[model samples]
Target: MAQCASCYFVFCLYCRMVYHGVQPCRLRPGEQRAIRDEYLSATPAAKQAMEKRYGRRTLQLLVDESLTQDWMQENSKKCPHCAISIEKQDGCNKMTCWRCGTYFCWICLVALKASGNPYQHFSDPRSSCFNKLFEGAEELAEDDHEFRRVLVRALPHLSHRSRPRLCLA
Candidate 1:
């Protein structure tokens, strides 16, 4: 939430609408990405102008969050119960959320706590992920391998930077 000094109108920074108490903003799609891209490519003068409009610290935080969110969306899945990003380093499709400890199916993002045997979902005829428990396992393993390689290569240079080097490969 932020306030305009001239108008005294308080609003969400992401949605640019009147502030709502404790509710998530319904921000326009690609809005954050647009801002981040512009900021990243902006000239020093343009960046200064942006910082003047949006505080330097706020803008930096927004850019960082946008970058992190982008990376997370690509590399991880949100826990069904807690919504915390969870990456599968090496495992089966069944996952337990670290934060909430809710058992879930990684492929379908369905909470499996209600099911006595979580793995049964994969064999259940009516389930979406039925017969596909280890779907895309090979592809994901290759991608994770590439990501680890990229991260190892980027680690030295990343120490000097404020943001982690994204492994887009």
Candidate 2:
């Protein structure tokens, strides 16, 4: 059988993320996590290996960044001068680099850290800036994004100057 598409899309029956030649899952939606979890526990060595290989935050980061692997996201080009893990705080297009504390405008992604809602339900500087920046590649859908909880789908909003698209914080 062809199997389910998501299985091939995300990972394999072994809980190992499928890099190539992966078949789809044969279970219901969201069943993979539980199955993968149980499967991991059943294998003591593999469970330890898996735990060493991943964690709650890192796994979520992988999901949030999506499998897309954008060049912009990989590097902190948001501030060419400072060049560190910078995040756009609320209030303006100014982004505060956590490492250097330098504020910059759209030249990269609008970062919404935890608690700072960039969307504001309407067009905000962060979202608007980002929307403008991503005006060209709006069609491209992010396969995944930073998922704190599967039940909640909150994402960081870009300022008006940014490519005008939602991006991982």
Candidate 3:
């Protein structure tokens, strides 16, 4: 038995069909649909168990990609130093870019001087982002909830056994 490099689906080299563990392969359309429906309706814990049993890393990558795309759509800021997109999950407007270590204000998108106190930007009335750290906390929370809902909808597709073939060869 060997695993497909692209999809990670195990198969017998000689038989050229998916390995169904110890059971016979159930490739009938009705059986497949029933299994898919069961998985889709499963609880989060059950889905997690399925991910662990099948392909945890793949499922995680899919979830991360979906979340990143959603974040990019909802939040409109890129890290000044690294150019990587960022979303302010919560807290004050002060943001530290995880990729480039650049400290910036989430609201004004200004890079804060490393030599001075970061909170000074918030306190200074002259700064555009002054006293605006928690400006949209409630709205950000609601956006987060929507993101999670989108992730949950995507999980079923990620966990499906019959996902599209990743490689032609």
- The per-prediction CA RMSD against the true structure, in angstroms, equals 7.3, 17.0, 13.5
Task: Say which candidate scores most in TM-score.
Answer: 1
- Stretches of model 1 off by over 4 angstroms after superposition: 1-32, 51-58, 152-169
**Model 3, span 1-169: residue lDDT tens:** 6998998988955436777564433334344444445455789998776564445554444445454555576776888778888878777778899888899888778888877798898888997877787888888888778867665665565545533333212
Model 3 clashing residue pairs (backbone):
93-133
Lowest lDDT sum, 10 consecutive residues, model 2, at: 142-151
Candidate 1, run of 10 with poorest lDDT: 154-163
Tell me the lDDT of candidate 3: 0.67
Q: What would you estimate as the lDDT of candidate 1? A: 0.77
Error of 2 at 125 (Å): 16
What TM-scores do the predictions have? 0.64, 0.24, 0.49
Per-candidate Cα lDDT values, in order, are 0.77, 0.42, 0.67
Across residues 1-169, which tens digit of lDDT does each residue of candidate 2 receive?
1345665454454444453342332344375355454543557676555444444334333333342235335533555455564433223444556676544454444443435553442245544454443332323223233222321333242222322244434
Go through the candidates in order and give the clash count of each. 0, 26, 1
What would the TM-score be for candidate 3 when compared with the true structure?
0.49
Off by over 4 Å in 2: 1-45, 48-78, 98-101, 107-169
Candidate 2 accuracy as lDDT: 0.42
